[model samples]
Target chain A: MGQTNPLRSARLGSRATDQFYEDLRQGAREGKPVCWILGALITTPMVTSLGIPWVFADALAAHLAARHQQKRPEEVAEEKGYLRETCSYTRIHMGCTLLSEEDRSKVLDWQVPNPDFVIITDGCCSEWVEWGDDVRKRFKVPIFTLHVPFLWNDKDRDEATNYVVGQLKEMNTFLEDTTRRKQDWIKLAEIINMGRQAQDMRAAGQQLCRNIPAPATIFDWATALGAVFNSWGKPQSVEIYKSMKQEMEERVARKEGAVVGEKYRLAWDGMIVWPEFGPLSKKLASRGANVVTSAYMWGFFPTLMDPTDPLKSIAWNMVDVWANRNLDWQINHVAQLCEDYKVDGLICHAHYTCRALCGQQLELMDAVSRRLDIPAIFIEADVGDESFYSEAQVDTRLQALLEMIDAKRKRRA
Target chain B: MKAVAGVDIGSLTAKTVLLDLQGQLLSYSIVAAGMVNRKAARKCLTQAIRKARLRTSDIGSIVSTGYGRSLVKFGDRNITEISCHARGAHWLMPHVRMVIDIGGQDSKVISVDSEGRVANFAMNDKCAAGTGRFLEVMSQALAVDLAAMGTLSLTSTNPAQVSSLCTVFAESEIISLAARGCPTVDIVAGLHEAIGRRVVSMVKGVGIHPPVMMSGGVAKNQGVVKVLSQLLKTDILVPPEPQIVGALGAAIFALEE
Candidate 1:
């Protein structure tokens, strides 16, 4: 999946992921104040403005898992009485904390240094706040918690955004105090503008996939997202997205799909199965199914962020996302994607250990299937747990989806 | 272009079906899917071709299906067993709105529309619980013949409790019941009831629309069917030869090809 892609950003994205690891290791050696944060609200601007290194806990877990290096971390977490049912990313990150000196050297590619402080948000799930508190206790680090209310009414959007924006102001003081450096407000504005350009380029790249033969597969976007997520607000991210958008334009002009024989255009939900990423992509491409879009990738990245009023814009973007809404919001979100992508089927990865992310997958599949009149399959997987993945199950379910699509085509004919 | 063939290489058996130009079943054969399913696929297709008194060259197209569908190198195309089972079950009983396929190593419940197109499907995770393999293992542990367990269970007055979902644990639980002087019929009946409960619960979760047809190797077991029928509160329909339905459906597709 990696080498086969003609997209330059895919290659650069891999380098960007590698650079992320290198930067973390170098930052630790230099004793930079690193904060492990949950919720995507403060990741980009906070790190860029303060001129300090930061760790996004979930991203590191995904990095570790993708490298086939999460086994010992899982073992350490399980030994510490963290049930396998607890989020695998949480276990992987926490297990990194509990790793013995010998195990850490063997397991981790780069040392995951202890955080100077913790940032927790209940915007997505309360579980993050609890996991954040546990991290706070483990290292005796202070925890900064922010509350973003769940919205059932579209009218509550402004209220939630305003509330979260107020908290972001307090967060600036906390960052300044933790790092003993003043927050660079001017730098924050610049980074936020840069992030907006990057997001637009990436979104434009994704939009090109609505073509008959999708010029870029979701795997292409998902692969490059490693760099995009690692450096969302940085200059390099803008270049990465620009390259990706250009590749999509070139491929569409040439009538070349990332998947050679695109047949069934499908949408995916839940976390990407990081451990089996390449093989998963290869297998689907073999079946002529170009999975063109995902709710996970589409919903997580902010579509719009006001650089002028950075916190208010980020807060508004955060509250209106799929993760923060009810089941109805999620159902409509995916249905709209299906129509937009011309997707005839859906694959909802029912990640086994994702308590926060996976509860409504079955219901989501059912509602979307009925509402959109498309077939949906929920294949069991764990986002970071390689051992929990079953190739047979994945093969059977996805094959069934293709067959369903074929049958529908026949009936229409 | 007078006939088409379908080969289904499953976990336990490889089956092949041949259909004539008029879309009538000509002949079919089932053989043990040995360690090499590729070999079994070849043998099964050959046997079905010969049984129909037709040469290999007569097959207009070959569609392979089941878990080992990819291994059928001669297949012109391959469809997953889920779609094949739905198509085949509908061909056999057109009114069926659902098909419950419990094979050797896996089980799935497929919801279909009035026209028999697949609407939705749910399958067990990578586990052998609620499948024919579980019964085969339990029969071995209880020293009961696999085919006769169904009849013997029908004679039980009070069934023993067999609650473990894992095959090994369920085997141990049944053996423990036997150790305590529980009747073998009671234990066997309990195994049927347990597997019935497990599979029916799955069907219920998928929201069963009835006129349900049961297919795959497990359909041959009367006790499991009887128990499932009771739990689902619907009389289940079973084709004369259940395991060949997937291959039958594939052959149907080959006719269209």
Candidate 2:
């Protein structure tokens, strides 16, 4: 199904103008606080700074929101319908939601829109957001926006750091000048410091686990410590980290039964479905495959990390740990998920234009296949660049893969 | 009467150079690679042979370099661009110590020893942001061809500031500038300055000394070369045909081997 522009005005020309006026009046009369549910990836920070109480939905929020949009069983048949509509990992989490409608509605309404002062800060492609103009209508506040580029090349670490710091400084100046209000630079500094600390703790944990026996338990402990440090002195962050850990543990313990007729459990790694996640998920389900786990979903686990020994962690993680641990962890984490999920195969989507993500696809696929003895099909696709993909070619290749999986299963049986 | 042929098939163009046994260039030919490596190599070879007024068998040995070096199936040997470039620069100016070859997809700073051998080298090939591709993309954004950029940039009395070093960000930066009614010349000069800064930093990272030679397609961009020379606080030597340096080096290598 084609996406009707979410922000498009219904009528063209003067009709749109009239509709906009009508919207403004309705918004004024209702006097509801403008609420913005910010996607929590990279975009969260910038949005949150705009005084929007960003909806703190992890991968689950995006998934649930996508499912809510797709209101029919047939809609679930096409992978592109749900999975390709949003980020796939988010869609999957949202699809797995056991929350009651009432509770979900409350969660959705968590933003207090009155006086329109809720901001969300999350990481996404650069930092950007889409919100209703109701807040602007009600409060007449300008939406301040700041976008960070998503490229990460540590080889150019000095240059990248200088660039980022410069952008941040410029953004700070813009915020102060535009709003005629001084930002809490202290808060920004604290968050940055905490982020760096958390990064360090996670690094240390990664190194400690590498040469040790009982690696998983050690890593988990290290991760939990890192999460605690990452969420340091922030009640909301602490609460979210606690919930995430509890949820992860519960999910692991419950070991949900395989869907009735599901034949293969697959794990996806890296970015997915910027615009077509809904359709992609439905397509996969039609093939009787379940993506039980993904790295993107699990990768956010470190966001919760906080450490007692931040300096120590940073030293170990940033200096002593393997230079590519950040990427390597994602790959290894996905491999671990495949094993834990008892997945039959893995599909590693190497998106074009995302050199950082795509760069590791070949190496990850090779490593995963060698370690697990599972057939890994590495597919190249763009997250949003539709021009690079051929649906027919992909479908043909997928069908052949499913057949190969079936033959392998039958032989095992 | 002996002559050697060198072919450097880069990502965007193919260059072939003919050198007499005395290491003097007899002739050279450069043409677009046209997205087909094999055909581009053949075209380059044919053009060079015709230009040199000699048949294919007249060449004693053929050496290939650049990204598409292996595509030259007719070549006697394939040498890495780094080695070939060093040799080529050495042949051009025996006193030259460092050779900076900035190609379309990759850039390198080659530190040469006294004997024209690669002593220490640094390369940035994983990203196109720091190469001639960045300039090409900027040219399109600025509505100019590769050739016109240098001359147009020279007209800028006060170049517009370009902050982003990343290719995508830099393009968007240019777009935003154009949207704000910034002049084309200023933007072009800004781009040249940015690229020059990037190249200078790369060279500085590997420790650049005097008598640095700049080669590759980007060497044709006088704007970048001017800014680069200013940044380095020294003169940069550009051969008569800068793009053919890699091929010239390869041919020199063929003779030595």
Candidate 3:
């Protein structure tokens, strides 16, 4: 947080976020019809263009709960008889809508706005289907769900693209009926182009990390890349990426890295512990070890899309999202990142309750280490839940890993 | 000779080893790790110093290891038990390539390089099963001395099976086994087997390099060692004083500096 990235200016960072939320709250207060959009398949630009406000329930709930030291939204879901084993992101997002009025009033109480409608996509996690149902029940809003099948093999790529394209057409019709406005193809293509530009800018910024004494840390990527998820199709999101890319290029030219000494370059392959981000980053900085790349920060940049074909482009992008792919794809993708970032070691966080994230991680770690000939450390931590984290446990484990890296580097020298 | 000390404040026990500049063992002390880890660490180190007929100032450097390592405020540095165990086990048995450390709160399998550094390692998740806590709880349920249960379990004609991996559930299973009038010896044998099986699975994940050795307090259990060796198809080596391995590793590290 201490002067890591110049891209994170007051306007593009916290102030912009505050204003965005303030606009949403104003929308809700004015009885504007709010549409709830699932993460990973965010259609913010589509809804924004229609003069409709969209809500990302999980992001709002997670940020508020962690910042205000209130009961995590996941706890609320558990109270409503959702099993603790449910994905934390989905549970917390669903829990935000389920919070009783009185209970919501006591906490940071950022209520999930009463939705005019909710949209669910065939997102990476299987839990979104159930999350959409919960949103429907709690808010009593009509729900639109999209089904996008897995796209791993090249053989079925065309079929998958067509299927998603068809769904997008149906979604367009649904929007027209709901808002009584015809779909604007030209405007949509422009938005898609902006989103594509933002993706390229962000990727270029991340590529800069490959340089020695990385211009940005993994935490910086996590923070700067977040807007891509929530607001990517907008001009503001594109501007954020533009500023970030410029700042990173300047840092590289001036020879500045995230950590002071920047001795050990590392890559992380898991979600950051959002609640403990400050403490964890500080600890790493204190030891002169910085995470230059993170697989989680690699946004689903739809590979090589034709901007003229908006629906097909969106479909292609959805399938390319990191979380939606098979383990082999993930391993190879992360291996490329490790090589690109010039990583000395890899740290894989096996999240406590995240089945998708934890699946085949041991095998992934083994394969990556073998391929890259670098040491990998597998640590157990809960990304969203602070209750599962222990400072003593993490500190000892990390100290040992850093020592191992140090020993390996010295041996190499 | 300059003296150095390694203090390991684990979940259940605090162990300290005093070593001379040549890395020769000077004296050692072990004490119950009570609630106050700092107190336990101080108590063990002081006892170790007295036994060696040296004053506190005689100790040049003190390195701490284990869960409570950070609580040793006087420590010159702290390292994890994973690295310490690998170093200590490799130091004691140079040919040893793997270290299975089953401590009070956690159990870990460490693969060590030829130069006695951590190559790779795997540890049990955030659970109490397959750890010293599991053995302690089972010994209590069986109403046997924690030290003697291992020997008594070896004499069992039929080892009862413990199906639960959770320590809490395993205790209940042990309780029900006793209620069913099952022989305490057999139940204890089965409990050891359960822990052995769990540890062996973890070892297999990190991969078993020979010769394998057992460290931590759990290594003292003959029943666990016998079952684990049979399961792994490899002889599990235990040091002369198995519980002091982590502290010994720390002392070796202190010696190097």
Candidate 4:
């Protein structure tokens, strides 16, 4: 019940996230162009390298949920026709954006400024497109949508590549026209390479976890996702991931463990309960179990691209994020992660509202479970809504999983 | 010289099983939890103690199980119903590798190994579609006695189609069918078929290794057992007193401890 042992560099992520907001507010304070990129799509090197500070639309919503302040934003969003059953993270985003300046002041210790421009990268679902249109109307700002197609390695792969390249070019032109700043090709390439380096380092840290007494738990990596989320193109990510990798390397050398008495090593397959991360991590640690690897913990590791060719690089990242892929791809991807991590079991946090991630979890769970010869459990929860989670139900399911694992260990022994 | 006890406090009922030093059953009792579950567990334990004619001090160990296991303050240990049911069913029928336990709020299929250890399990804890409460709601809608619905199901020549994933909605659907002159026997049969199909889906996920068995209050319903056995294409074993299976499992753990 104490803080999870092998204390990770969790504060690094918190610092990175805080610095992200500060940089955005600094852009707003200086009256510079600040853009809002909705969804995890292709809105990257072009905007950030142009000296225009950008923020992911749902970033603050995730922050609020982690800090346990989702109630007020949710209430406000509900009053404005956003239902609880429809993505609480989006509802909170809409709520904060729609709030009157005075009301927003009352609800916040800080603020997210209205964007000077909005780019809707609606590849995975139609929700982001609608959210983009709504924000465009509200701010009356210039908006561009890169219609990212969902085919990376299909027979029509070349067509998908050309389609995204054309859109990315047009979007770059649109950005140049809106901000009156010429595009910098060399600088763009430099940023992509840096992001590649950072992503590679993060991936390396994850790979080192194949060691027994895994040097890092998923909590360490999941918390530090802010580096990948906020500062991928910046030197900050390189430094953050470098330190992270060094810590993991040192741990691996010393044969130190992230969990105190780690008896089990499992992997998480879906979105985390951000607010309950500490409690959940501690609870698992108390049981001598460590969730050493997770699907989301590596950030953009699996979305590997040709960093030398920047357009192809961004295009691949834009199209192949796990959210946009089909079930077959997801099942194989999860299976590969389990094999790489050598996990004993899997826990899929089936967030009720996330149709994109959890849509095929049952089939994925069954297929991967049979293929890998390990058991997987599904825990029902929502990304940011604590009220939607059932603590007792989750506890019972997890306990049973541990029992099954124990039986397996006994049989092996 | 000493006896061990197991107390199972479920959503709808609490059961207590007492065992003598030789691991032989001494006595057991079941009490409806009503709205006050903790009180029900105490009363069930008290009745079992009286029947066994033993004082509380004579019990050397107690293991509590089921949904309300956490509320049993005097319990030496609390185990999940999933494990309890698996151990109990496997003890009763040594070859039983699967158990279908339908409690008041949830239903679960537990796969057991040869040694009575849980190999795998899947639960319908998110919904009440295939649980005892689902049948109870339908029986109330049909004006049939809770115990009589099972017998009536066996007489259903033409079982009606009752397809609603939700228990509350299923009740309304049943009512509409009854209004349209659909027979209660047919509807009861439909309910049993629905629950049987749901449990089969769960069992398949855990990969059925059978000598399948049924346990819990719903196991007393012969029609449900018959339907479930037919659906799985295997003869199912039911303990003579199935309601105390979880408590029995817990008592086994207490005895071992």
Candidate 5:
């Protein structure tokens, strides 16, 4: 059984997403209100049920960067005294807001829909706070921050759960005041149920990459993230994952991999350099080494939450963000991913200026290698800034890593 | 009578080496790398072949490494400098557990296992701070020859501190020091110390295990080597011609092939 590549599904999913953006843009233009939601905080089912169009600012930044137009906006942000060391995504978000409404019309390729207000989460990466502040200052937009607490094992689950529930109720009041629309409890329940099904199916698709000669690569998982986030509660999102999971299952039966001549399985940790994704993935695959898993790409797996109690479910999901976790938790999560994938090696990308991600990478690399008996390599580069990456240097490190893996295998044999 | 050849096309220079079946280096050449890497590679290879009194057809295998490896269309295969450097250092001194290579455009520290396989490695940021280009720029600023700066720096009693690891910022700092009539030798010593400090951290980052050897064009600078050895607190080994180690390793790979 030949595996069905999600190429068709990806195209359809992207088309649907594009249509959603266009619809939001048109609505915003006609004075129909919209909210700007951070993609990482997208409890899409709940937000959609609020009867307001919402755009994920990070997705729009990803969109512009994918189109190769991210640098100018970042430069614009930096010129305004935002530290260059800040997350490029945050800079890009600020840059999008800095564009004059008239200037934005010229580059209709990808624009953050005009926002009435911005809703985001606190207690995640501290960068979100700076990003939220910049938006509030520059765009004169009001920000509603859902403060999720960091859960230590010492704390009771109910404490965190009840706190998030309270915040969700506050969010309901904010939306009602901003949009002049009342909350519909019945509609919210249906959205939450759809979201639950969609999450389970997507998780199933992601888990299938663990098979030897994995059915799908990390790139596929990354590509499907937009659909998973944006199309949550839509039957189409569920259908996409259903087909993707079926294809992966067929590949598993055939012992097929996403790349030909699969010689080594690896997992990637840290944010991928978006600009180099195509070239880098091709280079890895050409060497018969495929990235079978990544903690970054598969974040936000569905946690059990009651569909009837939508606010509690959304609150619980918000607290589960990987970025908010302690270093020990992160290390264990990555170690578990390594064991789950049975990876031969780990590629720890030390992205430039990403204090949150790169701060602990040195420890993570050494720990994973020593604990798991898996060799790991550190690749230093910036995710959005092309100037920070040295292609030859990256190639040297990757080749050496692959050769080390080969040596380890030969030693075993 | 077959011989193997290795070509290393670095950012600043292209080098080539010819070796016999017994792994003895027969001949080698190092030349300035111009705008075109393919042309420079061909030039170095032809010169090295002629120096050995051998025809191109006499070479049985050809392997390439370094930044311009892909541009060598005639080569049989291209390998990365990390693997090549580790092999070369291991060939020279089998006990070398760490290799620090400071090239024209980049600096790196590679950790090697007992069998000469790369265990782990770390490279400098995408800037010319602890690299040959930094020295070249500073030498120009000081009105001193690149080769003589190293020897001159050894004479300094008290070196002026050059703190910035950034190439551009350090240049501005050097100009102001020069304006203050600071001795060229002292400033040059400071430059070496700055580079040594930067490279020492990188070595430690990869978990500094010694019997460490240094390679690449910058290895010829005794000022840097002396300061680096002092900073690392270990004797650093350098080959007769530091620039050709990558090429030598490429030849070693060709012989095995």
Candidate 6:
């Protein structure tokens, strides 16, 4: 099996480049082929589109190796190094995507004709690796390179224009140097227009979906898709929101049971399926406590967003409503859920890693508690990092709360 | 003399105090935050006014502080707990240059100037490690009322070391200690020690100054205070009803207004 080694070292006189090449050479000599080191900027959607069979890093390496075949090995290596240094997610994904001998052989041996042009597009955050790979796979063309820079909303338009112009100038320089072609000013202008068109399409799509209710689960997926596909069109957020509301209504209606033992209904809001969710639910069940509803699972409903016009939809949904836009709408939506469920208490889990989600937990808890007179408990936990959570501590708190609720019920009885 | 009322509705409790034009605390009341914060605030205010035997109309101004200050319907002014705690602690202890408040869901260290204003402060509102809530969880795990944790911790000979700083993990760690036949008192003492260490790190992060007054509900726990004092190598002062310091500060603000 002729294994194509994706790892390349160009003799560019830099010690770092030399060392990287030497490492690859050593691996090759040892019969361990290194293929596909993905940068963190590649997203799941990009991966799916690229028809890449391997993980993130491996797919990235393979994509780069195939796309930048005409370029010297050192240049590709430098790009990979630059990518790893900047993005942690890219680094993690790249590490995950590195391929073994059998996998490397499969990718290297696969034959596809090279295309006339390759266009690379990136959103604000790094997931551009997947998009680049997708274009490479589909067109079989070397990307001439396309980059979309992200800017803060408060950024001055004049400053942004200057920055974009500077980027285009740099790309022109790279094209001249790489292809040994003279600066074609007219073609350059056309290329800029194309980039703007792509950006506009995505922005338009996001705007159309701006009104979509954010479903907690499908947010990342919808946002990524919108950024790649729908920059110009109106976003599909409103439709998604309506669909989600319908689904939730049906689910709630179906779950509605006869008022049997206790009239008190408690709901846990915030991220769940965390370390203590199993134990917490079990404890509540043992006490004949019915957790009538939760925001954690329901928060991710897909109907809250439509990805038909993904870019505009994502941009609209990702907007921080509390500090920037009034979250009165979301507050009312949550309040309605509580009322419809006939909830008596709410447990607000303020997860540690999520700054945006955690910021509003206390305020929301206070508001809902006041509006409904339902006691709310704010349980703190780290969703992925279990080292921070104390199970015994949480259980004890929950037990005390249960006793308090029981006492309240008995007094009423 | 102008009379004013300041309400500091904290995460764990609601506090209200009455102040005269001269900045003297005429009367004060503390109440647990039940299901309804509005009712709790009204009740605390009524109780404090009753203690002074003054009419609500006599109050020239009303100021609110703490996390729950925004919810106070009758308050004329709302101030951050950070500023309120600094002002209140300065009034209570004139020489107090540093103030460490461990509330229900958050912890703060306020540095005051000679004139008694917030010079610089550091706060950890993101985690439960150094807050009063951590102790509450541990107390419940030990099957002890929150009030008894301080006294009970004093009796433990060999305190079990709680390694986890996270509240959820600390609970499991306690259960594991229990399984390993560790005494409940030792575990309780360990929890206090862990919390003290966390708080000490935070205070040290901000560079601690002497004459530090430990206020808030956690200040009531002598074990935590003792360990915190030892860790920082400084004497910690706890006022009667330390939880009301923010309210006291708000009342003082009302007096100045």
lDDT of 4 by residue, A180-287 (tens): 998888888888888888878777777788988888888887778777778887888877778878888888898888887778889898878876877788878878
**Tens digit per residue, CA lDDT, model 3, B42-121:** 99999999999999999999999999898899999988988889889988999999999888888889999998999988
Root-mean-square deviation of candidate 6: 19.5
iRMSD, all candidates: 1.1, 16.8, 1.5, 1.7, 1.5, 13.5
lDDT of candidate 3 over A210-253, digit per residue (tens)? 88888878777656544654566777777777787788788789
Kindly report the TM-score of the first chain in candidate 2: 0.45
Candidate 3's error at A234, in angstroms? 1.3
lDDT of 2 by residue, A1-413 (tens): 11111101101212322332344345546653333333323323332343323333332233233334322211232243443434332333333232345544534422222333323222333222422132334356655443333324446534433544455555556555654556654554454455554445444433322221211221123223223222323343433334433443343355422232355666666656434554565556566665555655334434332244322222222221221245565566667867766767777776654454566666677678668866566455655434345543344334434544553564568
lDDT for each residue of candidate 6 in A1-413, tens digit (9 for 90 to 100): 11111101101112222233344445445543222322221222222222221223322232333232212222232345634222222322232233334543444322222223333334332344564464456445444343434334434434543544454455445444444456544433333333344344333322222221211111222212222222112123223333334433443344422112223456666654233433554455454455555543333211122334222222332232222223454456567767766665677766654454566666677677668765566566644334446553454334434534543464458
Please write out the lDDT profile of model 1 over residues B183-219, one tens digit for every residue.
9999998998998888887787689899889999999
Residue A312 shift from truth in candidate 3, angstroms: 1.9
For candidate 6, the lDDT comes to: 0.55
Per-candidate TM equals 0.93, 0.43, 0.94, 0.90, 0.94, 0.47
Model 1 agreement with the true structure over A1-413: per-residue lDDT tens digits: 22234466667787887787688778878989787887654455766678887778888888788888888999999999999888898888888888887897767564767888888888877778878989989889987888888888889888888988888888878888888999888888898888889888888887898988888877787777764567878878888889888888999999888887787788999888999988998888887888888988766555587799888867877787788888988899999999999999999998888877788778888888888888889878888998888887789899889888877887889
Which residue pairs collide, candidate 5? none
Docking class of 2: incorrect
Maximum-DockQ candidate: 1
TM-score of 2: 0.43
lDDT of 2 at B125: 31
lDDT of each: 0.84, 0.57, 0.79, 0.82, 0.80, 0.55
Write the number of the candidate with greater lDDT, choosing between 3 and 6: 3
Off by over 4 Å in 3: A1-7, A68-72, A302-306
Q: Considering only N, C-alpha and C atoms within 3 Å, which residue pairs clash in candidate 1?
A: none
Q: Between which residue pairs do clashes occur in model 3? A: none
